[model samples]
Structure formats: structure tokens, C-alpha cells
Target: MSTTLVQIQVEEKRFRAHQVIDRLALDIRAGEIVSLVGPSGCGKSTLLRIVAGLETDYAGRVLIKGAKPQLHSPEVGFIFQEPRLLPWLSVADNVGFEAGRGGGKHPRVGELLAEVGLAAFADAWPKQLSGGMAQRAAIARGLFTQPALLLLDEPFSAVDAFTRMRLQDLLLSIAAHHGTTLLLVTHDVDEAVYLSDRVVVMNSGPGRIAGDVVVPLPRPRDRRDPALGRARSEVLTLLNGAQQDYHDIAPDIAAAPPAAAPIDWSKLSFAV
Candidate 1:
């Protein structure tokens, strides 16, 4: 059996004393792309953060390659919603930041810039590039580290529909070429279904894994394929159902369980 690239077991967490995620478990294999789909504030990004070791106060274990995650380690790379490039840096400099001063001279930097179609904009500063180009530069920056796993949190949410579609294709092609394991968090069910090997649906607040659907469609997936349309519908159904279920359970949860009294705020302490 192939070793898992990322693993989470019985993970739970709260932000500002309000529960966010609870009892989340997942195992992702190398070279596979897993997309987390849910409504906003469903803890998809929080879960990605926890996996990336950005937050450590959460309960449960997260293991990358059977070892604890390290933020300083190059094993994982993260791509956020925004491009977040330095205003003064040129496109090539921003993407090649991980490399030392002389490192931009590396052929891989040019190759990656070309792959993301930013080769022509190499000398363009952050302000000079379009939204899509900046985001592409950010992607190249993330890939510059050559991580074993890539965590993307709504990386295309801000882009136009046409640009979003193109980026999705680029992400898939890049992941396929490098055989990088990817975990993408997105609200777009169609985008999730189109790009993932598996789609993991998360419940609303106090998020948990509600559905784990395998995408059996052969890749490279055609976004317009009828089979893909059906898959998208199925994922949407799961997301909608999970949202309803959470809504129905909210009232009961608000009324604390009789045996297990209300949590003691005084004794509660944040994890390190």
C-alpha cells in the first residue's frame, strides 16, 4: 500500500471559544488531489491551516508522512486566497523568493514561470500584473519549494470565471506533472468535482466530515462532460444535505446535554 501523504485523526478545534471543527478524520495519498467542499466558515480553511501547522491549539493529531507537521519544513507548501506578493518585487523575484540571491538564475525558476504563463511578465512588478497573473506568480512561488504536499485555500476564489477555469486546469496539469499531493478548500462544488480525485464534504459550523465521495471519472477530466455534471450534482446534494442537517441540530446543541454540563470557561485553556 502507498504511504499516506497527509493524515488527520479525530481532529477538533475552536476559535475564540467557539467550536469550529470537530472529529475530522482524513487520509490523503501521494499524487492524489483531495478537495474540501462546504459553505463559508465551515472550517475548511481552518482545517487546512491546522494541517499546515499554522494553528496548534486544535485537538487531535495531524501527521504528514507519519511525522508531525513543521511550518519551517519544506514538506508542505501553501497557496492562500490572495496573491500576497511584495509590491516592490518583480514577478520573477516574487516567485523565486525561496531561492537565495543568486537562485533566480536557476533554470527551474524560468521553467515554472513559463509553466504558469508568467515568463513574459518576469520583469513586471506586482502592481504591473493582472489579478490572474499575480495569482499565477503566487502559485509558482508555492511550487518553488517543491513540496511533497500543496495546500490551497480558495486560491481561485477572487478570479473571474474564465480565469478561474484556466487556473483550475493549470493546477491539475502541474499537480499531475509533479505528482504532488494537493488539498484544496473551495466553496465551488463544480470546481471541486472537476479537479479532485476525491471530494470531501464538510458540515457547517463545528465542521466535520459529512461525505467522502470518490471521483471515478477518468482524468484529464473534461469540465463539460456529462459524467462530470452528474458528479457535480451528487457533491452538491451532499453539501446541501449536510448544511440542512447542521441547521436542524443547532437548536439541540444549544440546549446543553443534561448529563454533560456546560463547559467551564474558567478551566478552558487554548492549546499551544
Candidate 2:
């Protein structure tokens, strides 16, 4: 890994009476997909916002490609839980918004829409599209600027299971196709294990990373694979413990050996 494409080093971050992040330090390499998992109010979203240069009121340093991040960085794109599309804007127009970013040449709107399977819906209104289609359009918009980093905050959480799976595959394909580094914040352990190259588990209340586990499983991975199960178990173990006790289990669970027996993939159930 090169000298990290994104570096988040924060001593403290607060919102009035609530403290969000505490002594957080992480270096994300180029083209890597990393997930951040933790309990609610762990500052996961806040950290992501800082990385996108959207929240600068915190006490910390976020360096993108060795330089301070800025608003509309063109190097970073964000996709929130909801599609948050401008309902009135046509799909093409929403995607075309990326063009106004400092006169940068980007992948064409038609091509981007096509990549997300929205080729024919270019002129369609957001209300005319289904939930999945709208989210896909949001994805296309995110990729419009050809960002080096894509910040996703449970982008697939609102969709159905099947749709979420498809979107997960879409995300992986997009990352592989564009060589874009991804930093995702997800509550679904399986989803994190399924998509990430590495999973960094954090503890809540003044968020601090407890463990960083590498998912050694191969790409285009099988959901039935026991390796993913083991990885998910490790993350769950980390999350199941008290925030302070996370330090104790992070290494042990991560160091556990891979499961040898392949369980029926359908038999095991995980988050919605």
C-alpha cells in the first residue's frame, strides 16, 4: 500500500454536549475498500463527513492525497443512506451536475447512467423511478466526477434484501472497474464482510477503532463460504462486547482460524 490516499487523524470531535470521535487515526490506501462498523452514535457518519470535507468544525486533520480536503473536492464523492436525489431534477440533469466541478472532464452522463443500468431513464424524473433505480442514479451521480474515494453510509440499507445484494455486487463491480477506493459505514456485518477488503471495527461513544481485520476471501465471493462467516463472526464479536472491552477481543477474534466446514449458506441468517 502506498502512503495512504486518505488519512483521518483526529484527537477529538464534538457536537454540543455529545462527543463523537476520540483519538482516531487511520490510513486508507489507494483502491482499497474499507468498512467502518460500530454501534449508533459512534461518530461513523461524522468521520465520513470529515473525510468528504463536508464537516470541518471538528478538531482533527483529514488529508486527501497528502493535501487538505475541500468542499466539492472532485476527488471524493458521498452517497448517503437515502438516495437524496433532487426529486425535480431529471436523472440526466442530476448526473450532469458533476460537470460543473471546476471544468474537469468526466465520464459522460449517458455512459455513467448506462453503467448503472439507467441508460434509457436518462430523462426520467426521480418520482418516476423505482427505489432501486433511483439509488442507482444516485450511484451514477456519485461516480460522475470520477472520484478517488467513494464514501457510502449504508447506501443499500433502505432497499430490499435482493436489491441490497445486487447493489453490493454493483458497488464491488464499480470499485473494480474504476479502481476507486471506498470507505463504507455499515451496520450489517455480512454486508461489510461481503464487500470490504478490510473491516475496521469501532467502539461507540467518542468513536475509536477497536480492531482492523483483513478479509482474505477472494472477490466475486460466495456467500456460502465459511471464511466470510468466520470474518462476520469476528466482527460481531467485536461489536458484541462493551466499548471499553473491544480492545481485548479485537485481536483474539481477528486471529481466530478460518472455519473448515462449509455451512449451508441459506441456513445462516444475518441483518436485514
TM-score of every candidate relative to the true structure: 0.88, 0.86
RMSD of each: 10.5, 10.1
Single out the weakest 10-residue window by summed lDDT for candidate 1: 249-258
Candidate 1, number of clashes: 0
Candidate 2: the clashing residue pairs are none
lDDT by residue (1-272, candidate 1, tens digit) is 66788889746798778999889899999888999998778888888988899888888999999998888568898999999998877778888887867456667789999999988888888998889988999999899889999999999999999999999999988998888899999888889889998999988767888898888887887778998888888898898888787767786753445687789999999999
TM-score, candidate number 1: 0.88
Query: Which pairs of residues collide in candidate 1?
Result: none
As a whole number from 0 to 100, the lDDT of residue 3 in candidate 2 is 54
Error of 1 at 114 (Å): 1.2
